[model samples]
Structures are given as C-alpha cells and as structure tokens.
Target: MALDGQNVCRHHGGNAPQSLRAGERRVTEERARVLVETYGRKIETTAAEALLDEVQWTAGHVAWLRERVQEIESEAAVAATDREHPLVWGVTREKSGGEDRGTTEEAAPNVWLKLYQQERTHLVKVCSEAIRAGIEERRIKLAEQQGVLVAQAIRAILGDLDLTVEQQARVPEVVPRHLRALAS
Candidate 1:
C-alpha cells in the first residue's frame, strides 16, 4: 500500500520528461477549465462544481504530501552523510523511557524502511479516499440529474396529448414500443 516514486508518477499520469521545464509542463488555468468543461458536459452543474472544488483541495493535499516526502528523504540523506550510522540503521541518538537516552544503532534497515513505507502508505490511502469520494459524489449527482431529465422529457412528450395526471405518471412504465424507439 506504500506509495513510492513510481506510484506518484502513475497517479500523475506519468513522470515528466527530465528536459521539460516545470513552467512548460504545468497545466494552465485555461487548459484546466477546458478539460473541466469537456467532462462537465456529461453531468449537472452541481456535480461539476463539486468536482472542481474537490480537485482544488486534492491539488493542495498532493502538494503537501510531495513536500513532506521530500523533507523526509532529505533528512534521511543528511543523517546518512553526517552521522557515523546511516539512517537505514537507526537514529544517531534515540530517547528512551524515563528520561533515559540510548543509541539504537543496532536497529535493522528494514525497521526504518518499514516506518518510511508506512508514512507513504498512509499518504496513498488519504489520496485514494479523497479521489474516491469525489468520484462517488459526481456519479450520484449525475444519476440524480439523469433521472430528473428523463422524467421531464417523458412528461413533455406526453403533455401534448389529452391524458390525465394518472395516465401521464404511468407513461414511463407503459411506454409504447414506437415511442421508446423514437426516444432512443
């Protein structure tokens, strides 16, 4: 579940080419708006607005995660270079219970690695949940809108005739084959 650089790259669509400048590769506001509009057409305005809001929050969260990951890695690198014991082994000095201080240099690399991986896993889970919630919200909103549209369309199609309210309500349930074909 732990996310590595590969996972980050995958979620981002792919790793940016090394030669591409950050400014060159960044998505412009206009481009983002066009993309939202393109996808927005499939759903109602409420859903689109919700998606846009979720996207903004997700962007900020992702930025923070990236920064935190960088900080952790940088700290590890500095510790490895500056201390006699590498970060993989253990901390240079560890505080124990009852105000006792101890050097945990005997710790295995896997222990530190597991802690690092756990952090990444937690981040990945947070990211996944945020995205999943957004998708679910959009899906529910779109389905609700579609249901309303269908009802309105059916009412309009049956409205011109001299049918009672009861008959109009039953129109969808007993729609004629010809009418269904025409609608389709």
Candidate 2:
C-alpha cells in the first residue's frame, strides 16, 4: 500500500504502512491495545484504529449537526415572531397586544421534528457509507445506533464492546468521555 507518498513492501504483503513515525506507532499501539481490552478480545491494530476513527468522526459530525440544528431552531423561533409592518393588512391583534405567543409555542414541536429528521438522515448517510465500505453487520448496527441523542448513541456504540471493569479502566485516553461512559 502507499505510505508517505511511497509504496511500502507491497510485493511482500506487508500490512504495516511505511509512513508511521515513532510517535504515531506508539499512539497506534496504544489505541489497538485499548480496542482489544474494550472488546475483551484480540483486534488488529489497523482495524482497531479504523473503528476508533469511525466512531470519533461520527461523534464529531453529530455534534456539529446538533449545534447547527440548535442555531437553526433559534433562527426559526426568531422568524416565527410576528413583526409589525407600516402597511398592515388583514392581520388581527389581540386586545392584550403583542403577537400571538401561542403560534410560536405551537411551532416548537415542528422545529424539534425537523431537527430529528435531519439527524436521522445523517445517520442513514453514515450507515450507507459503512455498508459501502464493507463493514460487518455488527459494526453496521453500531453505526445505525447514532440518533438524535449524541451521548446515548455513543454509549450504545461502546456498549457493543462489553468491556470488563479492568478493561474499561484501560480505555485509551484518546477516547472521549461520552464513549467511555458506555463501558462504565
């Protein structure tokens, strides 16, 4: 395979890419060991790193999406507020004055529903990518667990590892706390 802009021992079927620096090797080994401990079973270094990368990337994307959704909701709420125009038409105002607050409250559910749909759509996109990458059914199932709740989805993904207490304590420092909580 290619590594650092050069091909490694491709003819010899060398699995280790030639580009790994000393520090990266240490980090990779630590991550691989953590994966094995987390799953209570042996896992190849490459595969472990790949799984960790996937989980991290998915979590990051979901977090970004959630933040964006919140921003969108804020915008929506502000937009839902009734603004007065100099040229008033058939608009009616209650004797109490001010726009109808109930209209804004009624829209809150729809805003939540729209955000939920966006999250679900993003999850399906991730799942499809996993399928295309030829991930196993177990991994696919884990990927699909990503839903509206970011922490809960991460917890569900790590739950599949079934890490023992000792192993859980040995989880890699690189792993986020939300994911580590699953093992706990």
Candidate 3:
C-alpha cells in the first residue's frame, strides 16, 4: 500500500532509511492512539478491573461447564440413545463444499463430557493466572488477597450501580455462589 501522506509505496523502500524509520514510528504511534481511543471508549476499564472481570467471566464459564458435565454424565448413565452432542461447545466446522452428506456419525455424550471437563480445567488454569498475578501485585505472595480482591470488586460494582430493591436483594444470594467457584 502507498505510504500515508507520502508519495512512495510502503513496501518498495523508495524512501531514505532515516525518513522511513520516522514514518514507520509515526504510523505505529497513530495506530496505537486510535486503538486506545476505540477500546477506551468501548470499555474504559483499568488493567486491574479488566483482570477482575476476566476472573469473574472464567469462573462463571467454569460453573456452567460443571453443570453441563453433570447433565452429560447423567444422560450417559441411563440409555445411550442421543449422539449429536458437539465435540466442541459453541463451535462447529462447516464442510464448505457442494452438497450436504446425509449420513455422518455423531460423538457420544461421554466424549462431550470429557471435552467439558477439559474446558473447565483450562478455565481454572486461566483464573489461577489472574489470581496468582493478583497475589503478586505487591511483589510478595499474599495468598489471601484473592478474597480481598473479590470483596473489593463486588463493593465497587454495587457502589457504582443503582440497583432496584429486588436486584439488591438478589446480590447477597447470587454473588457468593459464583465467587465460591474461584476457590475450587
């Protein structure tokens, strides 16, 4: 592509070496600024808040996978009738070619169960990274900091939102159960 605000093509190296470096630096900076503005406008969360969000998100996902795994196992215990459960949840590759094939074998529930367990394990590992990083935020390991962080995050969220009376009531019953998953 042509260089921005310049006559030469970017890939052809027609510009002098020093000018090319300066131009590349300008482009890089401008791109970074645009990205910051766009992302900042969209979410506006600090790094700490982002990590906290990721922890909650991963914990919620792990909770869902646990329930799904139990259901799959329960189904497997009885009869082996259904077989269309996906190998990967939320994604399936399409054949992209011409006509659809009529006959195709499907994965059994045990396979899906194992996949869900693996996903939950991976998600726990992801949350552990966030937890460990939080523990190290002070340059010394503070194993109990996860609880404090969770408490602080909850306080921050509840403090910021104007919840209805019902919503406020629900927080006590709801938040602790999901937060409990992080300990596991």
Candidate 4:
C-alpha cells in the first residue's frame, strides 16, 4: 500500500500517480481479505501529536460553541409588536396512500425555539464527553502516582527485611508483573 497526497492507500488507487516510500510494505488483496475477515482492518492511530492537536482544537471549538449559545441575541422573549400582519403560519405537509392511511402532519413550535434547544442539547453532550475524558485522564495520572509510591514502598520493605542475595535477585522479575495494571 502507498500513502498518497490525499492519504489514500495505493491498493485502492492512490490520489495521484505514486510509489511506495522507503520502509513501506504492500499487502496482497488476498492476504488483506483474510486478515480483515479474522481481525478487521489495519488502520493507523499511532500519532500522539495528532491526537493532542485534535484534543486542543475540539476544546477550543466547544468554548466557541458555548460562547455562541450565550451570546445569541434572543428575540424569543419579545412579544410581536407588529399588529399590521397577523397571518402567522407554520406549514407542514404529509401524504399517504393506503386503505386507512391519513396525513401525518405535525404543528411544531417556532423554528428558533427548536434550534435553541438543539444547540443547548448538543452543548450538554459535548461537555459531558469532555468531562468524562478529563476524568479518565486524571484517573490514569492518579494511578501512576500510586504505582510509584507502591514501588518505593516495596523497595523500602525489601531493604528493611535484609533478604539474602538469591532472594533479592527474584524481586525485580516478580514486582513489575504485578504492578503492570497500575502503570497504565
């Protein structure tokens, strides 16, 4: 496969005339088909810098959306002062063809109200997702802190116990295996 100008792989035809880069490998369609059937597709997400940039951009976008929600000049509360034209209408049309079918039209409230609610609902969901991501990040950080303390305590205890050299030789191999979960 080849990485091309549009990020498309050459296996499916690259965006432009292309050639593989120095360390690039190609997978045959037959091998790829079998691999995909068993384990799904191979995709890339190994770029940590890209993920960080995306997170920053999303956070900025959320703040901007929040400000837009607050900064909107609402005409919702203001009563209609124009008495000259009162033929206000909200039209909805539906059609059905069957023995017992009828029109399915609905009369919704003002479009502005619907938009306001939709925007606010979207904001709530995005805020919730951001909050959960933050909490997971913090939880991982705390676990790392605790893992360090545990390692230190284990070392200190080993020092206090005055174990034999043969016994000391076994600790390094055993400790890391047990502390693996906390490292993440």
Which one wins on lDDT?
Answer: 3
Model 4 root mean square deviation, Cα atoms:
16.3
Better model by lDDT: candidate 1 vs candidate 4: 1
Candidate closest to the true structure, highest TM-score: 3
Runs with alpha carbons beyond 4 Å of true place in candidate 1: 1-65, 75-87, 92-101, 107-116, 123-184
- The lDDT, on a scale of 0 to 1, for candidate 3 is 0.68
Per-model C-alpha RMSD: 17.9, 22.8, 14.2, 16.3
Greater TM-score among 1 and 4 belongs to 4
* Candidate 3 lDDT, 29-130, residue by residue in tens: 989899998876566877666776776777787788778777755665565544443332323334556687344444434455666677778777766877
lDDT of each: 0.59, 0.56, 0.68, 0.57
Taking the tens digit of each residue's C-alpha lDDT, what string does model 1 give over 12-103? 64445542333234545556778888866554566545555556655665566666556756876776754433434555467776656776
TM-score of each predicted structure versus truth: 0.26, 0.25, 0.37, 0.30
Residues 13-115 of candidate 2 have per-residue lDDT tens digits of 3344444564357667878888888877844677545655565666676677667667755765676734431112222332444563422212123444455
Select the stronger candidate by lDDT from 1 and 2: 1
Q: Which has the better lDDT: candidate 1, or candidate 3?
A: 3
Which of candidates 2 and 4 reaches a greater lDDT? 4
Clashing pairs in 3: none
